[model samples]
Target chain A: MKLYDYILSGNCYKIRLFLSFLDINYETVPVDYYPGREHRFPDFLEINPLGQLPVLVDDEVKLRDAQAILIYLASKYDTSGRWYPRNPEAMGKIAMWLSFAGTEIMNSSNARLHDMLAYDLDADKARANAHAAFRILDDHLVEVGFAGQEWIAGTQPSIADVACFPYVALSRDGGIEHDDYPAIQSWLTRIQSLPRFIDMPGIHFMK
Target chain B: MSINFNKYHWFAFYASQQIMPAEIRARSMWNTDIAVWREENGSIHAWKNRCPHRGMRLSYGFIRGSQLVCLYHGWNYEGATAQCSYIPAQPNLKGPKTACVRDFACFEKHGLVWISTVAEAEKEPDFSDFGEAEQTIHFCRSIFVNESPGLVGEILKTSIFIPYGNDLADGAKLKIETSQAEHHQTGANYQAIWQSGRDKKKKTELTCQTEVRNNAILVNHYKDDQGNEGSLIFALLPIDDKKTGVHVLFSGDFSSQSLTSAKRHYAKWAKRMRWSIENRNLQTDSFNPWI
Candidate 1:
């Protein structure tokens, strides 16, 4: 599998983390996204006309969108039921949450982070959206305690936790403080303590 | 040669969407013009959708015991393969293929009946994805002429599938039964038939144009000029739907505090897919017809 990225993308980092956890072997194809670079080239369009990050290529299969790749890997390789699990009820529980990450967090939170990193920080709107998202989590953590006793989906650390971890884990870099939600904070600590956990790949890995 | 994918190529097709249910093609099981019927025993038999002697669609035909008698001709067809069992003048010729109309290929799964698009067929269609925990909804099928299945997989953001099963276990369950674990056999309960064909005038198969609106992508699976099938179905895993949280430990939304200028490209891909489908070859790498 070939992973295309700019190195610092937290979205890309998510792929790397899962790959490391499963120990699935793959090759990384780094795409240059600087002014008028790899994205606009004819070759890239042939690969993914949509032109997005973290494209996982396995022979004839090319996965461009992050969320799709996350599902593909988890569904394809996980036999342990520890990562991507099976069972109808557990399946529904996981599906609804993953959808939330796409429809909500990525659009509201990650979009703001991407904008801020681009240098035009809409601090006020970003801050408001951040708080709005936080409130939802605050209530949720209260509904279901945040202790490491059980991972996001009740028992195991699943793609649900993987899907939500990165952006929120690095929210501080984008100027959103993490002090407000103690439950969320403790949950973060628990995730960090996992056995095969790896650090978020930083900007320098691009070269 | 123009590939019609209709009666000429595929006689029938079936898809067992991982997150969805198995589907059947009941439209083409006609004998001349009469439709087929099954007895209470779950046996499937076909006939002309219409009676040859008069012309009433067999869909309107009545089933008594194991026989399907056309309401118009009062003609009786064989209960098993739907051969004409009785014709006022042809009683002696009884239930033979010569006295029959059309008998299409019918296959079954789970608890449903499936007709084929072709005569000579081999290999069960790939459906390993149904066992995967991922979300796969076979809503409206749109075929881009000659587009590869893997390419189709890449286009999907939240839902997709690869043609090869190399990425997944051949069977649904993975068990360690012996030292040679590779030889251990496992299983997944897959059903091809389930007595669930909804009756409607609009052809069940359709096609439509998809677009990117606001920031969300909308795929409209409405009908087109040619007769086809289309509809929108979303298959995704569960996650928190709430958009806001009260604090850090409580949420995971990213915030940008840095003054450094960051450029984020806003992209929403939208395109209209045509819905002229002929043979839905379960074994196809290209969902489109092959000329």
Candidate 2:
């Protein structure tokens, strides 16, 4: 499988973490985002007319969307509640959160940042947007921590952890702090110790 | 099911569309006083759990065409009026078409039956392809941050970063270079990248211009514009480590292709930056605690 990827994006990081955790081997295809031409190129468009990065084109099919990609991988791979499990109730729980991740974290965190960062709004709104997501997670963390256990869903780590691994860790990039969140802190400690654990991609200090 | 209050009162919850099969028929929570059932021919009827005169849970009643007769009383209730008919005690009296407990709305689809109190229905909720195609295989896990629905939608709309930790995992004390929000004019587009154990924003002068393909989704955020609240869209894209790598494109083109990629590509991307996601579960990860 070849991945059209950007190092700094957290959305793409979700998938990257899962692959490494599962021990899957693949090559990363770098799109020349700097020149801005590669993405619009006909060849690249042919693979994914959507023009999204982290486009995974493999022998069987071509796919896009981090959440969708995560679903496909966890489903195809056989794991006893390892990455993707087969239980009905358990599946629902995981689905609910994954949906939340796609809608809530992905949108509010970055949108708030864009409001300030892109000059759409003032700094207050950007921080407010970041805080909005923070409160949502803090409320959820009051109890039933990590699906009632060390992992996100079920008894062990699954794609749920992989899918959410990035934004959960590095929200501070948008100036959202994590010191106030104790359960979040605890949860972070647990996931950080994973065997194939990796750090976040750095910010563009000198764009 | 139908609910009965005092004085022959009638109450029904829209069960489904009134065309559901027997298997998914009882997904209604209509007060639980009466049982709703479908006759063999496909018409619906509500009967008391007991014979109108007797007291059986009409749900156990048998369906004979449009009329439902109590199993024990053998007293039939007409579907048209929900009125009692052919009562053994009052054999000669004709029953009203409304003698039977009437069937209401409610059915199963979007995972469960969603019933409304008002009669006559409007359009159903648009369950997007996003809802149908994706499945969260892991556990409920936790909420990352306390984000509102609209704001979260915006984040999704803007950009999704896959934290690629190839070097960072190896203990690279990569100084999280910081910068201020450029606050550019003309709807400026940019990506905010964060480093682990580091909290600061950095500005980088782009050496080149490029396209950042974004996700098709639009975040639905509501804010007070004037005296009223309004909505705006936050578009998103998925970025990979290879091109936008912590090792490489710390500053690079953000695109929509990142939002739409194969599962393998996303999985690979997830693999690269997972340590961070796991570590940074947001503050709003939870929902309705202490329930």
Candidate 3:
């Protein structure tokens, strides 16, 4: 397996973290997504017309989008069927939240780009939208906790947890604090404690 | 009797199954911040999220046994009353009476955790019409909408023929029997009866009651037919002026197939409703159903 990776990109980090959890060995083909803007270069554009980082190529299967890669990896590799449950209800939930992480959470990542990478955008509005998303997530997690389920989708952690984890854990980089969302804070701790969990630049292992 | 903070009846805020841990949870209703928590002994409490000591949100606090301790200053509040019990800063000095957090009346029934700003009235919002308490209750995931509860109510009243998809019998036709909206001093109630199936003898009757209280809407549904007799309740919580949280619960003697089908059906219906509410460009006039 080959991963077109960016060390600092949260989307890239989600793939890295999930791969580590599955104990899968994959060679990293580094993409300079930041200062060099290498993802937009001709070579990277050939791999993905969208020029998104974290493209996964496993044998004959080449995938774009972090969420798509996650579903593929979990379904193909995870024998336990815990990471991406096939049940209709759980799949529906995971799919809904994956869209949430891609769209609403990507807005927060845009705010992070403005703050950390000096990208030109309305950081305040992006932060506000991120906070709104966090509010909903925190409320939902509280209910999930009450139901004796520790993961995002079902009784176990699923790809939905992985998809939404990175941006929310690194929200502080975008000037979005998790202080107002205690349930999110607790959830981050739980995700950090998962076995074989790997850390990126912003998300750290829990003590 | 106007639709203010005090006139609203019991409003289901969260599912009972979701309040599993003994921790403080934050929620909003009609733009009012609320901190909901369950004690270790399984008692639930809802209070104003604001801390009286320093105006910090109590939802950011941690729970210790039966007390909620403020995150900022460690001002401990008892679970039931939300009265200040101990202050870490001034342990010897008794916590002042004025330091108590404003608490709301909370109750749990039919797999729902309800909170009300006012005292309980002579009679609670009736759920007895649904079913008995011991039946299996399936609580669906809540959906959030970027629309007012009144607007959602009007949409539901006017658009009664929305399909249930695979949840109904094959080739079943949905027909609205009676649609009525009665306005009270506090809020309004929209009631409608819908029947499905070409065979009138075996037609499934679905009765819907939507109560628009303050800024929230509660819809209770009763279904009776040859195959199933049960009820489903929906509680809409207004998080702010532009956002609403919807909680759903189903109670009845249901087969596993019907339960799974019901969950799938409502989840899609909610997504569609939310999209229509957010994108539709309709008249902004007051929701007067009589006209």
Candidate 4:
């Protein structure tokens, strides 16, 4: 497996974190997503036409989108069937949250890109949308917590949790503080506590 | 009901469990930004959010054992004294005495963490009304309101709490009447009477009593129709004039089986109260419910 990754990109870090959790050894093709802007180059564009930082190539399988890659990796590698469960209800819930992570939660990622990488985007709107998404997630977590469940989808950790972890953890870089989302903060701590969990530039190991 | 909103009173801000070890919670209370963290030994500390070395938010830092390490530079501050203990750059030298983070009075009580801006506070809020000595206090949730604490407190006085148990039916109209005509802005104290819908076949009435220990704690005692009693405690933390945090905790004889659903029920009530209070003005008959 070869992953086109950027150290600072939360989207790319999502893939890297899952790979580490699975304890899979893979090669990395580092992309200069920052000042170099190599992701926009012709060759990099050929790899992923979306100009995204993370493009995973696993043997003959090529995947884009962090959530989809998470699904593929979990289906292929996670023999334990805990990360991406085969249960119908569990898969449906996890897929719902995966979509949420890719769409609504990405606002935090956009805001971070605007602030950290000086991307030309409306950061205020992104932050506002990110807060709205965080509110929904925090409320859901609190509700589920009342039922004694820890992970986002089921009783166990799933790719949905991994899919949603990075941007929310890195929201501070975008000035979207987690102070208001106590449940989300607790969930982030749980994710950080997971076995073989790793951290990127903004998100650090709690230890 | 005269109470001081400025200082000397312990205000509950976050739920106790939210301040986990090895993590920092940044909060603002009484115009001061506080960085609250707990040591691995389970002792908690709240200090000025700014690091004396470079004004970096100490909350942005990480905790290593008994020390909070600044992110900008590896300046470690002792959790006990908030004093700069070590600097990686100056490994051979002891940190200067001036490099200390200002500490605040912080403690946990009644399932919530309370902080006092002043080093010495009057006393912790009294939770005897809820029988804290015997009953287990369950933290429902904390809601951040983009309004004044006074406003939130006023609204809470009239805020209806549906019984967590199967005591009250849906669409039951509840009206609140307070004994006092006017409540002081600093703190509140009043007795309330909650009357259920007159339309019900058997009208249920609850005499609600509120006790304010200090400027922040509001204990609402309720007796349901079935003679079961419960207490809803609201600890208001005035983050500033505009921003306020309301931490809700409930105490009752909840069986182990029913506790989880009870918590979920009250959490929904708290979130609804926040939404209504925040959007009361924009609410109209024509208001889009889906929006």
Candidate 5:
């Protein structure tokens, strides 16, 4: 298995973190996503048409999106069957959050891009959208806390948490603060406390 | 109303549980950056967020045993004295005494962590009204609101809370009454006399009182008709000119099942209260989201 990865990219870190958690031996094809912008080059675009940071190539299966890569990795490698459960209800909820992580939560990524990489994007709008998404996630976590559950989709840690964890944890890079979202803060701590957990550039190691 | 927290007074900015052991959290108040962390031995410390070495945010550092190791260059600061304990580059040389993060007076009480801006504090904020020794304390949540502490206090003066554990009816409006001040130096006391007056013909009065002690602590006591009572302590922390954080703790004799339910109920209420305050729907008077 070869994963095209970027050190600073949270999406790519999600794949790297999950691979470490699953104890899967995968070769990392480093991509100069920062100052070099190699992902946008023709050679990298051949690997992923969308020119994204993380493109997982495992034997014959090729995945483009980070969320899709997470689903694929968990379905194939997670022998414990707890990361991506087979239950229908759990799958539905996890899929919904995965969709949210790719769409709404990506606003935080865009904001970070604007701030850290000096990308020409609407940082204010991205921060506002990120705050809106954090509000929803925080409220959902509070509701789940009422049921005595910690993980996002279910009781156990799922790919949904991995998909959404990075951008929210790295929101401060885009000037987004977590002071208002106490529930989300607690959830981040719990995610960091998981076994085989790893940290990237912006996300601090809690334990 | 502007609150000058630069003086020597203990203000509770966060719940005790929020500061996990062996974890570093960045907290700010009155434009002063603070790094509040807990040791593995359960001892809590608050110091200036900046590292004396390179002005790096000490909050961004990690904890090793009782020391906060700076992320920039690995300068270890001791827990109790905030003195420089170790330097990774020069292993044998002792760090200078002046190379220390400025410390503050910190204490944990009533399920909340209190911090004093000055190093020497004559006394901690006395929350004698709650009598926490007699009741079980449950931290509800710490809510960050986009408003001044003074305005938040004013809103609390006339704010109406939802019923706790199906105690009051759904649409019953709880009216608030502002009583005379007990004393100014310590804090003002407002008797939040609420009347469930939705149905004017069948008016039911549910008594609840709020006490503002030490200009930071707001003690709210709610009693149901069936004698099921709970008190919520709102410890407000003024972050800056436009932001305030309210740490809430519930003290009552509740069963395990009822405790969780009551915490959920109050947590939702606190969230809605923040929404109301942020949206300008709540004010000193004429603010009733329940209606």
Candidate 6:
């Protein structure tokens, strides 16, 4: 297996983090997603039409999109069936969060791109939307915790947790403060405490 | 004005069990970053989190058995001395002594791990009261407060009143007998007494002592009523200038059932105190003179 990864990209980090949790060894092909813009070149576009990062190639299977790759890896590799459960209710809940990760979280990640990579965008509006999304997620997490559930989907941590983790954890890069969201901070801590968990550049281990 | 690091000569940074993981953990004290880790042999160490080479965070490094290896350059540091034992880039050459990571004086006692920035500090803080009843020590969940340690100390001096076990006999009353505050070079110390019941014929005594040592607070509780004796220790660690972490250690001669009740009561009390401290508008002038 080979992962086209960019260390600074939170979307790429999501797949890398999940692979680490699964203890699966795969070669990383570093993509210069910054000033170089290698992902847009013809060679990379052949692998991914969307010109996005974190394309995973396993034998005959080539998967795009971090969320899709997370589902595929958890479905095929996780013997415990906990990461991507087959139960319909669990899958529905997980799917909703996955879509939330792609839509609501991508707005926050775009702000990070503007700040860190100097990408031109309306950062203030992106940040405001990010905060709105975070408020909803934080309130949802508080309710879930009251129900004695720690993760986003079902009783155990599923791909839903992996999907939404990176952008939320790295929201500070976009000038988003998580100080007001105690539940989100606690959720970040719980994710860090998972066995075989790995951190990206901005996300450090919470003591 | 910069903080006097020596004021934290002997401070409790974390509970001993907190460093149980074999991987390196990160902690901050007075704005100084520290990398804490426990080796396979169960020995704990605290070092400056910055690697001597290129200033990479050592907490981001990995532990290879007992040696901590920096993730950036693979500089291996031995556990006890924090001396660079091997540099993978130069495997054949012996790593220079000066290449070692700076270490702090660390010692574990009474269920807490302490770190001192000053090297010549001869001994750890005298937690002898808690040490005397080692077998009964029970640690409560730590509380983190987003407030200055000094402000938290002031609040504790004036507003903190932890209740004794709820299982006290019927018609029993716990009243504060004496409250005394003293100032020391580092911080302040408060001592208080609580007398149970109005009847002088059958009286019970509860004594509480709190030591505010710079960025940390050490609390000791003692109860002597009808041949029942107990002790509890609460240690606070300053995570940074404005954030504080608190840990509780309870020791006493009480039945298991009573101990459970005491633990639950103190845990809730600690949470409430933390919430109050974090939410209160703390003014420097409002601090007690002694504190």
lDDT top scorer = 4
Query: Root-mean-square deviation of each candidate, in angstroms?
Result: 29.2, 26.2, 7.4, 3.7, 3.7, 9.1
- TM accuracy, model 5: 0.88
Write model 1 residue lDDT over A27-62, tens digit each, in one string. 777888654468678888887787767688877787
Candidate 6, residues B114-184, lDDT tens digits: the string is 88877787466765555344556776545566787655555554432444543333344334433455544
**How many backbone overlaps does candidate 1 show?**
74
lDDT of 6 at B248: 65
- Candidate 1 lDDT at B53 equals 56
Local accuracy of candidate 2 as per-residue lDDT tens digits, B1-291: 111112111222222232233211221222334345554565544333445565655643456666666656678776666677677667887764444554445343322233333356444433232111342211111122222223332322222332322112222222211242222211223233323333223212211111212211232222121221122221211111111101111211224342222222323332333233333354232110100
DockQ of each: 0.01, 0.01, 0.15, 0.77, 0.50, 0.08
Put down candidate 4 lDDT per residue, B1-291, tens digits, no spaces.
Answer: 123454677888678788877778888886788888888888998888999999999988888999999999989999998999999999999999999989988778877878887766887766665733578888888888887877777667544455565333344444444445235443334333333333455545555556555757777766657565687888888887787898888987677778987887778778767777778778652111112
Among all windows of 10 consecutive residues in model 4 chain A, the one with the lowest summed lDDT is A198-207
Total residue pair clashes for candidate 6: 0
lDDT of 4 by residue, A102-151 (tens): 99999999998899889999999999999999999999998998888988
TM-score of chain B of each: 0.37, 0.33, 0.73, 0.84, 0.84, 0.74
How well does each candidate superpose onto the true structure, as a TM-score?
A: 0.39, 0.39, 0.63, 0.90, 0.88, 0.61
Segments of candidate 2 deviating more than 4 angstroms: A34-37, A40-42, A108-127, A146-148, A202-207, B1-291
Which lDDT value does model 5 have at A10?
93
Candidate with top DockQ is 4
Candidate 1 global lDDT: 0.44
- Kindly give the number of clashing pairs for every candidate: 74, 146, 1, 0, 0, 0
Interface RMSD of 6: 7.4
Whole-model Cα lDDT of every candidate shown, in order: 0.44, 0.45, 0.72, 0.81, 0.80, 0.72
Which segments of model 4 are wrong by more than 4 Å? Answer: B1-6, B131-133, B166-207, B284-291
Residue B102, model 5: Cα distance from true site in angstroms: 1.0
Report residue A119 deviation for candidate 5 (angstroms): 0.4
